[model samples]
Target: MTALTTPREASDRGGPVADIGPLPARRGRRQHRLAPLIFISAAVVLFILFFLWPGALGLLYSFTDYRGVGDLNFIGTENYRELVGDDDFYRALGRTFLYTALAVPAHYVVSLAVAVLLTSKTAKGKSIARVVFFLPWLLSPIVTGVVWRWLFGENFGFVNHVITQLGGSSVAWQTDGTLGLLVVVIAGTWASTAFNMLLFIAAIRNIPRSYLEAAEIDGASPAQRFFKIQLPLLAPTSFLVILLTTIGAMKEFAMIQALNGGGPGTENMLMVQYIYRTGFERADIGYASAVSMVLMLILVVVALIQMRFDRKSALS
Candidate 1:
């Protein structure tokens, strides 16, 4: 009896071979094509379920008079019209912008400074310093707010106690709107700095050492080297940090809420807190949804502007 050869072996030997099925390599290629889709299917599902669907519903509700319950009577753009003329809405939006303006710059400066320090060649105890610097980013926003509140509390607080001990009057941190907002800005910056610092650190470390060495050999001072080489190179990372910080500051709610409950007569109420109060506290879901849509539009516009600026900067 003749020994049977496998199809591959027969083909190799120049004999006619019967086709069995798709080869393992072809099957593997198919699996490879499918692997990414398989891995990302869960994330896509979650995005649709949690984000897209809700956003669609919110958009739909914004055109109606849905008061969290009852009949959804269609009101067209009345909610938006009302939002346009509402002084409280404008104040909240303005306050939100103010917070973003204050917080983003502070966040950028502090984070970049820390990142530069940590990434410096002559820095000491880098490992310990990195951990200490990064710890605040691990904290929940509410927790951070609560901690700051305790430190800045109006009466019987640590800060006040220290001031009084040093023969100074107790400051109205919570009651006074400006002081309250200042505390929130400080807390927000402190809470958010670590993450941005990590981004800056990565960007800085990725900068080629040869550039700095070349600059130094050309008689450039540390500040000159940084301004001419390091700072220019860090543009992309800086833009990213600014964009993210702006968005985070715009959407700030929980921290401010936990800190002063948007208190001092809604003086410190940011847009998100305003939305929450309008939707939940007052049960004006449709109008609140409209406000949220406006906020979303503002964020989209800001992101687009930043991206455009970044592209221009990159080109120039």
Candidate 2:
């Protein structure tokens, strides 16, 4: 009887309630406190290294005459003031806007459709097909540029050779402003759309099969189900892809380098390429920094506008 009473006392006093009641809660509290601090610390470090420090340096340099090396002098808003009258700045801006308008939609439309097709079982050899589609993207920009340059070569090139064979005169592809820009645009689209295809493919695969099956059962066709149900659900993902691709297009330099090297007469010169020409080629660091800041402002404004539209669409 005494032994039984001893065991009951131990059970009541030394059970989980006594050992774990406040201990787990205390550990959880500690973890909660540490987690945010850890996250914030990491963010602070990364922001300082990646964005804040470089931005601060550029902002300061924009107001000075720091052309790589030697003496530097603060010149107020002279850099900005000079840009107002710079014809190159205006030209770059115009070309950039045009490029964005054309390339962004072409990329989204073609890639999304390809993604849909790739996701379909009716499609044959999906992995082999993906690899084929992705082949352009896998090559280095320099390599693509060299190949295209040879194809667009003035004489004895594949492109012109074909033209002559077809009983047409051989044209100087790179020297023709219209042809050069067109080639750049097409190559840029072809090179870029594959990555976007992969994104859409991933997003499409994650969609619940039950939802699609139910839509089919209700006599909805593939087009109607895709547009009304799938697209609506995939809205956020599409928005994200568009935003990123647009931003990327705005900053395009490599593809242009590969395709036209900023073209026949600076006609295809995008803003970043213009900025590169200004800083390194022309040796005007201060003015180039000013141009960069302007580009940054444009991107930020666009991003804000996109965010507002996204939120509005999501609510609607």
Query: What range of 10 consecutive residues in model 1 has the weakest lDDT sum?
Result: 148-157
Q: Roughly what TM-score does model 2 have, to 2 decimal places?
A: 0.84
Model 1 TM: 0.93
Backbone steric clashes in candidate 2, count: 0
Clashing pairs in 1: none
Q: What CA root-mean-square deviation does each model show from the true structure?
A: 3.8, 5.4
lDDT of 1 by residue, 228-272 (tens): 999999999999999999999999988888889887889999999
TM-score per candidate: 0.93, 0.84
lDDT of 1 at 269: 95
lDDT of each: 0.93, 0.86
Candidate 1 segments whose C-alpha is farther than 4 A from its true place: 1-22
* Residue 116 accuracy (lDDT) in model 1: 94
Best by TM-score: 1
